[model samples]
Target: MKAIEVRFAKEIDKSFVVFRETGKYFPCPWHYHPEYEFVLVTKSHGRRMVGDHIGYFDEGDLVLMGPNLPHVWVNDESFINGGAAYDADAIVIHFQENFLGKEFINIPEMETLKKILDLSRRGLVIQGSAREKIGKLMVKMMTMNGLQRLAALMSIFDLLSQSQELELLASPGYTPRQEDQLKGPTDRINEYIMLNFHREISLQEIAGVSNMAVTTFCNFFKNQYRCTFIEYLNQVRIGLACKLLANEQNKIVQVAYEVGFNNLGNFNRQFKKIKNMTPREYRKRLDTQLEEDSIFFNEAYIVNE
Candidate 1:
């Protein structure tokens, strides 16, 4: 058996970068990174699984993922089934908070900016009017260089720190260190399974993806993720199904088929096994979430495009 592995984000190479991708798959995965991340998904009609915060994300979704939190952006059936094309153009800033100096943010004048970075570690989504303001700054940061770039980053944080319209992504007690993420072939296998697991993926299929034999892949998968391949697959499917259950437009059978379970019976059994609740119960919880979410919605009304 091999040891477990986790990978953190490598946003550290530079202070910031603007990425533009078309049709290419983006799966940064559940790994955390060293730097704080400010990202806006301009396109992708998929659900966002940030830490424990789950929700339907259409185009123009603005989110701020804090340092070292488990999260991923999954392409839904539309992109997966239609082989649909989409783009993810984002501005990511990765820096050691006091890379400048301990005295930089410690000054009374910089208290607000310092506070924002502290809150950022737990991850947060910039919302309300600030969402638009931040989005503009994100785009603007791309055209900057030298001291200009650093200045813009500081201004962005200054604005974000004072804004009351932000949502935290992860809960308390969530610590993301870098060393835990650099796992072996397990990440490759998980990535492969996520892309293909939606279509009645077999052990042979997953094994082939791993470029290993069934006997070897099984042991490796368990050793790295601490779960059998099937267990991991079921978790992925069930996780998607949980998101789908919130949509009133989709049916249970539709969700079952959509999430990659060809058979409805198996979907139900597996959903129950992992969630300890039936599909309807899941829907019920979603409805409750919607009601609860209305409170947050009232507080922040920015994403209403």
Candidate 2:
């Protein structure tokens, strides 16, 4: 899709921007910005699209994306449709690479921080104990000011640089087209597919969107995405299916059809191929994980008491 470029409002006193957003749902569209971003979802569950990577995000989901990476978080239907009781909330931090001045990052002491910034170009999901520690630091930064806030940000970066619990989101081969180079044939094709993936899309239809012959379009898509067009479509569908599966209220069959799978057998096969587990198993695992987290929280609270 052609992502819109979003510019941030500059603050005269701060080198970075940190704020908590709360509403019926996240209101951002698919967009890109020049500032690297650190995001922590404090409430809501939804699908997050970062570059060509699609995944489910829940409360406590944290990610860092380098400058100009297209991304958005769309809350679940319940949140958006006013069926949920609580509002969606997130804490976000945005800063340019030179926010602290180019000289500061070029110094020998900042080598690891520079490396982590470079890795973030593909987007990174902070995981394990690092996620918890960094999330706390982010929350603390909301109340901090001046040098204190900057120090906390540096601490978060240091943790990210040394920690082994980082997962890259976008595919290694994926590169976001810059604004100057957008509106190309491939970009149109991507927009069409993403907008219409919930229904049957024919080869001729996609080829028309790309302004190419069917055979030529197939070859071009394979070369550009490192996979067949069908494979890419299935990846997008399965990604959305995952978010739907997270809510146990949705039946597996309904989720499959909702995500554009016309048949149960095909959905099962594709889900297993991409996720390494059947839909039922994936849902069961999510439940088990939630239960474990609740138990851990209760025990920790009791111990503190």
Candidate 3:
């Protein structure tokens, strides 16, 4: 998608931002900003897009994204169209990579923090007990001020740096260009592809968007993105396909065409190549997992009762 550039109004005397965002639903568009973000979905169920990865998110969804990584959280259909009962809420933290100091991360004591920050370029989803602990700290940080708030943030970072339960979003091949380089030809070309990937996009048409010859555009795209134009396009389509498949009502073949694949065979081939499984297998696994979660939740509730 063509992400809007978002600029936050700096709060005077504050080196970082930590606040609760509540609404009928998250109103942010697909966007990027020049700050690393820590987000914990406290009350919501939705689809989260990070870089080129698409997946479902629910309450307790926690992710850390590096500066300039494009992302957005879209509420589920019920939250968007349902009446007043549904409310989306999250604890959000935004900080510059150098918030502590330019040389802070270079010190021996900060090695793990530095490593986690580097890994955040692909975005990291905190999982298991680490997520629970960090979520509590973030909630506590809401009421804190001054040194305490900063201390809480460092604690969260400490937890993240040591946690093995971290899942990386975005593909290994996906790279986010720096914000200063936005609107350049390659960026424009990428935006165009993201916006039109659901429909037919011709090589000549995309090259025209870049004002380059077809051959030149192809070479330029490969050099800049480290992937062929078609490969990147399929990556986007497959990402969307993963989201659509979350709704069990959507048929597999229907999803293929919906994601812009011209034929079922080609969709299957690409899906397997990117996802390492057939669509059918992917859906089945998702269903099984959901069932297990539901069972676990119910059992815990009964025991508590």
What overall lDDT goes with each candidate model? 0.67, 0.85, 0.83
Candidate 2, residue 214: how far the Cα is off, in Å: 13
The model with the greatest TM-score is 2
lDDT of 2 by residue, 1-105 (tens): 578999999999989999998999999988999999999999999778888777778999999998888998989889989999999999999999888787988
lDDT tens per residue, model 1, 1-305: 12223433445545454444445445455555555566676667665555544455665567766556566677677665657665544445555555677677688877765666666666677777888877777677767766777787777777776677766655456555554444557656645664565688888977887689999988887887798978888888898787677669999999999878989899999999999999988898878787667777445433311
lDDT of 1: 0.67
On lDDT, the leading prediction is 2
Show model 2 residue runs off by greater than 4 Å. 179-232, 238-264, 268-305
> Which portions of model 3 miss their true places by more than 4 Å?
178-305
Root-mean-square deviation of each candidate, in angstroms? 6.7, 8.0, 8.5
Candidate 1 ranges with C-alpha deviation above 4 Å: 1-34, 43-58, 66-88, 107-119, 127-129, 140-155, 162-175, 219-226, 244-254, 289-305
Backbone clashes for every candidate come to 8, 0, 0
Q: Worst ten-residue run, lDDT, model 2? A: 296-305
What global local distance difference test value does model 3 have?
A: 0.83
